[model samples]
Target chain A: MISLTRASRWYGQVIGINDVTCTIQAGLTALLGPNGAGKSTFMKLVTGQLRPTTGDVRVFNQRPFANTHVFRRIGYCPEIEALYDDMTGRSFVTMLAAMAGIARAKRAERVDEVLGMVSMSHAADRRIGGYSKGMRQRIKIAQALVHDPEIIILDEPLNGLDPVGRKEMTALFLRLATENRCVLVSSHILYEVEQMTRQIILMDRGRLRAMGDVYQIRALIDAHPHRVSITTSRARDLARRLLEFPYILSATLDSADARQVTIETRSPDAFYDDLPRIVLADGYRVEELDSPDNNLEAVFRYLVKG
Target chain B: MVDLYLLRNALRDLASAKRLVVAAILIMGPAFIALAIRLGMGSQFDGVLTYGTLAALLVFGFVLPILAVVFGTGAVSQELEQRTMVYLLTRPVPRWRILLAKYVAAWIVISATGLLAALALAAVTYQPTPGSGRTALNRRSIVNPRKFLAQLQTPDSPVVDYVTQRLSAETLEQLSRWDPDTPAPRPLLRMVLTDLNKLIAADRRLYDPADFPEINVPDDARQLMAERPRGAANARLNRWLLEAAFPDLIRTNRTTGNKLYRDVLVLPVGAAAYGAFFLLLATILPRALITGLFLAFGWESWVPMMPGNFRLLSVMTYLRALAPHARPQTASTDMMQIFQALSPDTVPSALAWIVLAATTMAALALALAIFSYREYVPRDDAT
Candidate 1:
């Protein structure tokens, strides 16, 4: 577990992270943000690579900065792509496993096991310099997992992966979360983090914007108007029917296609409940129904302005 | 086990083929220069002078310090430059241990490369001179005391004031116009010998081994001590005194091969201090390589030349004390003589050893302390 109490980090006049606080427990919790959103700085604080400029960052109830005990319990995968180019991936993993205090007799087994988990066993013997970006990302993940840490913090871990690789890594993160380990992944890719977990801490401009389940966050932001698009032959009739409800803020009939109408309403649940009744009673032809505000992207867009 | 892995990783990085290539060039550079000197100046080549100049100016002064800066700053900067430091720093090991392990690896490399340069220079330039032969030492002393006595004839020697203080006015008068060429005035010669014996007994820095190469004492006194005849009667009594008087001139000349080995012994201690200083520099300043080079060449080059007690602050001064060598005179190096004249001070061998150890410990301790507490952002990540 990691906890940040009014944690703020600054690089000279530039802020890395502003006054932000959160607690992360055992599960795959994505840190959602855009570029320079202070995600990497936040992760660095938890991994003991940096000290918070003005707050208390505690990992497992101890300050993480230069604290070897805390370091042993946490594994960090940084965003930087550079590695010891001359070293083979296997040797790189072994070296880190040794640094992690893994016994020599079991280091090889542990290294191989992690390499297999990341699907890097085939290229494990090759020099890292020759590895593709996907391979490099996997190797980074492998090193983070080699020590069997209780908490794994990865910054932009899915940056360079292919579609298939992304899916596999996402699944791996999900499986890791299921093992009762705290997995905190930070990414600017909103869709990718959404695929990993609904549990997230959303940030923008170095400040925590929102934290909790996507639906839960969405439910809390009911004051924002929601858009619903419906394709029906009786677009005029449906618009008139939708306007009868007070929750409907506006209705725009699509001019290019006369059969479609888009309605804006603050209360989507009430709208959805009344929509089928209106359609069934009128005997109307409702060929398609869709709402853009139904998923994490809409929730994220609604939560953080960025 | 973690320490071992850290050392191995650092050593592997240091011994990379790319670095080895540069180190090879550094190691062979002196030998190549010596070859050119041997070929161009053949027969006229004073092996002692050639070896001394190259060893001091080229290898010790330039090569050694430059390597220390490159290797020292490179020890940690290399990891950060490659963005590999994050991996090491995140491990369950103390930051100081990681840095110290890398420093030890860099120190081993700089010391070895410097020693090789010195050895290669000595090997290429070494020629059997008069006192170089084992049995030849008994017959031909490196110093021709007759020539020395002729040079010492001037009355206003460094000893003029020394004798005015220690001897009777009568003895000073007899010693003033002395000459070894003319038929001997036995009593005056005996007086000169006795007075010289007093200087030897005093254990003064006037003829310090470190100063022997530079030979900066006032003309008269330096002339007397530069080389003395091993008169059968005086040899037994004065041998130890003469050696202690100017060991660099006597020992380095008699055993040319060991000069480099002796330099080898001193090189690491010097590198350790220089390396530790650079390690500390890298920790405090981001542009440490540039700053270190400025300090290595700009500060270190001239600080030992600074007037008065200021020379005591330089690491180079102590290094010269630990392993004195003949600093060959050249137009560019005339600044060294000027500084030597201005600061006629020398650190004793025992003191040099102690001070170097203390400074090295101090620098490493400070570097370790700063590294332990501070945070380093990977350069790419910082942007």
Candidate 2:
């Protein structure tokens, strides 16, 4: 487990992370936050690239700052696009594996394995300078996994990846978690994080706003109003019926379309359960229904505001 | 083991960099100049030695240091500028080892290039048959021509008559073409006189001192005559003349000695010291290139010109201290004067080398300390 106790890092009065205290245990955990939300700073702290300004951070009961013992067990995929572009993908991964203290005899096998794992074996012999954005991301991931560290911390690993690449990476993270390795991935895209893992640690303005499984955190913010949009031919009639339900806090018609209605509800679970009954009784031709607050973005907004 | 790995990787990266090509061209400048000089000018051993010395001075004193600074200062900063430092920083190896590996790699490049250039310059200018078979201009025979004439003024001076008879009319006419008061005799007259002097000395032992009593011997000659019986005085005088008049032979000896001193000692030590110092500056300063330029051009250049012990701060001063003191035959008097003025006072070669080694170690240690403690954040990540 990696733990941060009252960890605060300040760069000349601009706080990167302010008094953040949390523990990341074994499993795939998504670090969800907007840009400049202290996610990168937290990753740097955990990877031993930085030290907390006021508090303590420990990876597996020992300090990670310049701690080779901890570093050997941890793999970090940085968010920055920095790489030795002149080197072939295989050479780059092998070089890092060697630096990570892997035995010379095992470096080639390990590099090939990680490259295959990232589905980059086809382009492994090509120079990274000519690789596309998705290829670069995959090569970066391959280097991070070349050492087979116990903890893999990737910041924005899905950035620039295509749909298929994202699916493959998501599966890779799941496999890592299944093997009991701690996979803490930071991403600002809510849907991407949601697709990767249900466990998330959300942050805003350099503070940890919430941490838990997505569903559990969503349950905690049930008191807040949830926004759900409905598309139907009889939107005005649905809005009137939604007001009749006591759980519906407010309802509004779409300005451009009379067939669309947006409604707010105090109890999302109750509303979701009763929505089919109401539609069936009124015989409204509902084409689509989506609860904006059901995903991690709404959970983050509600928890940050609360 | 980790350091070695890092070093190997760094060397590989350096080999692929385009800057290495530029650096190689810069160091080869002296070698090209030496080859040109060899082709244009005749390979007179003294002339070649003078040219070689000047080449060594240009390379070791200025070009080598600038190259070392350019390469060494970029050793770590290049990684930071490209934002690839994070890869090495995030590795399990210690930060000091990373810095050290890069430093060693840079040193290897700079020293190898500089020494190779020096070797090429030396090889091009070196003469295999130095001071051999050049009897026409025996420098010893020309020394103190008036004294030689006075010695031959005796009535039964067969040696003088023989020399005058041996002189060709053309040579005599050439000798008379110059002003009588000129210090230097005509070339043919000088050669004939040199041969005459050698013959007289060889035959002098057959004659008694009383037979040449009118020949006024100088105090040193008289002491030599008293110290040794018979013709030993003439032999001593002959030895002194050969030693004094042969400027080419003296220059040849000095140049050979200087070449060994410079190639074997000064260049390697200077390259290492400059490389290490630049590595330290690169680690500690944000603008290492500008600072290094200032130190190399502005400070090192001026400090040597300052009066009285002020030059002790300059690396060039220590280098000059370690260099052989023989001035090149082609060097201008002004250049010689400057070199003499800048050279430190009687510093032993061993002491100078020790100072250089100590400074290199200190700079490397300081670089390691700075690299170990300093935090490097990628530019895009800095908030």
TM-score (all chains, Cα) for each model:
0.83, 0.78
Worst-scoring 10-residue span by lDDT in model 1 chain A: A215-224
**How far off is residue B52 in model 1, in Å?**
2.8
TM-score leader: 1
DockQ scores of all models, one per candidate: 0.54, 0.45
Kept native contacts, as fractions per model, are 0.68, 0.56
Please list all clashing residue pairs in model 2, or write none if there are none.
none
Q: Measured by TM-score, how close is model 1 to the native structure? A: 0.83
For B1-383, candidate 1 gives per-residue lDDT tens digits of: 88899999998887878778878998899899999989999766778667767877778788889888888888887777777899999999999999999889889889888988888888898787765523212323434444333433542344333334555456667656665557546565456556554543443432343433433332212222333423432332233334333322232233456556668888999999998999899888877889999999998888887998888888988887766665443435466667777765566677889999999999999999999988888523741
lDDT per residue for candidate 2 within A1-306, as digits (tens), equals 899999998877687899999999999999988898899999998988888899999999998887788889999898888788888999889889989999988878888889999999999999999999999999999888889999999989999999999999999999999899999999989989888888999998889988888766776776777789999988988899889899888999999977889998767778889999988887988898877777787898788777
In candidate 1, position B245 carries an lDDT of 37
Candidate 2, residue B172: CA error in Å? 26
